[model samples]
Target: MEVDYSDIRVIGFDADDTLWVNETYFREAEEKFAELLEGYETKNKIDQELFKMEIKNLALYGYGIKGFMLSMIESALELSNNEVSQATLSEILNLGKEMISHPVELLDGVEVVLKQLKGKYRLIVLTKGDLLDQERKLERSGLSAYFHHVEVLSDKKEKNYQDLLSHLNIDVKEFLMIGNSLRSDVLPLVNIGARAVHVPFHTTWQHEEIEEPKQKTGYITTNSLANILEYL
Candidate 1:
């Protein structure tokens, strides 16, 4: 189905994987975390338990590298029956710090696309994660000037997007969201009667994975950020 973007007056961009490299760091951190806990359990089991810990603690810690670090620590303790060494815990903390301090690497055509769309429509960042961390990334990304607003949502449910649209004083049909995750960035906006475009990242978190079914028509999927320029 051909979706229309002629009415899109406000375009919301997902910051992390959409504009810059993010999930890749998380994947690397997870591998190191699994290695650290290998003595307590198999890497596979450690990975599974870490994921469970993260999901279990989502409400308490929300999303970000800090929460992920906490989950890693908790998973280590649980898997090791509290016998995991203090040295290993320190290493885990270091891993989190490394991720937090890592420089932001913008994806190809991110600047060009933002430049093309900046004056054409209201451009804002709609993403979820640690607010400070996200802000730091934005600062490092040098893309902050392109956005009119920046929102760090605790979660990306349909209601969250609805509230965002309401807060921004944007009509549902006039909003367009572009991002990497179909589950978080695309489906919720489409469900809320807004347009969305999916730009798949090379690596995505397992939590954000969704099975694509035929016949869904409210959004468009582009292979790169540059492709979004065609619609907007």
Candidate 2:
């Protein structure tokens, strides 16, 4: 079924993978982290432990490189039974610092898509992460001027979308969210009577994965961010 996007007056974009290179850096960092702790555990074990620790620490720490850095440290300590050396810990911290300072690399066609839609709709950024880090990335991304507003949400749940839309005085029916995560960016908006377009990124964090509902109707999927321009 083709959903009408003719009513979309505001388009919310996800910041991370949807706009810039994000998960790739995390994947690279995880590899480096696993190599750092290779003496204590297998690479597979290191990956598993780090993911488990991250999930365990999500609520307490929220999301960002800082929380991920802490999770890596904790996972190392647990994997090595407190035998993990201080030098390794230092390296882990450095890994996160690298990610925080990494240059923002925008995805292909991101600028074109944004540029084409700039005057046609109210463009806004609705990403979930550390506010400071996200702000820094936006400043570095060189694309801040395109968005009417930017929101660094702690998370992207149904209530989060609801509150933001209501607070911004945006009509739910006229709002459309475009992003890389079905769980975070797509389904929540769809549940709130808002439209959504899922632009799947090449890589997705495990926690962000969800079973697509059999009754998907309020949203549509596109091969990439650029493809969404056709429907809009």
Candidate 3:
């Protein structure tokens, strides 16, 4: 498929999972928490419980370390019959904070692609996570210079994309979204009459994968970030 990015004045990209590694760290911590809760509940049972708690907490608390820590504490306490120690709760919260403060490592070829597109395109980083966490990562990665703007959203919905475009004074037809997920990234952009390109990540986060593609839209799929240069 040929993509005429020459008319695209602004190019927005997703941060976590799209530009850098995010879900892997979360999955690691969850596995450790599961081991800690082994005597209280089976792995499958714990995961199912945690999934429900995650959605609930996401609605109530939004995203980031606070929401994740709260969800973990709730899951642990419920599975342990409300007998979880204050010390364990403290430990879990500290771990979540640690994950945010951790190093920023870009995915393979992300830097290369960013370098290639920087001067030619109006690059913006549109990510959804805790504000501080996103800021810390951007500061550490030193890739912040490449972007014209950085937006940390509460969620990736059609409204978020629409609002962003309105704020920037750009029409949806003149913008392109590049990201790793079809669910949060591509589908929402397609909904707003914008173009999107999906660069599939190797490890899929449960919340990030889209089983069905949004139809009759300018959505392109690729296996790597470097491959996008051909279409552009």
Give per-residue CA lDDT, model 2, range 128-180, as digits (tens). Answer: 88889999999999999999999989899999999999999999999999998
TM-score of each candidate structure, all chains considered together: 0.98, 0.98, 0.94
Off by over 4 Å in 2: none
lDDT of 3: 0.85
Off by over 4 Å in 1: none
Best by lDDT: 2
Give the range of the ten consecutive residues with the poorest summed lDDT in model 1: 212-221
Report every candidate's CA lDDT: 0.93, 0.94, 0.85
lDDT of 1 by residue, 190-224 (tens): 98899899999989899999997587778988898
What TM-score, to 2 decimals, does candidate 2 have? 0.98
Candidate 3 residue spans exceeding 4 A from truth: 1-3, 214-216
Clash statistics: count for each candidate: 0, 0, 0
Cα error of candidate 1 at position 45, Å: 0.5
Model 3: per-residue Cα lDDT over 171-222, one tens digit each: 8998999998888889899888888888887787676666864354678888
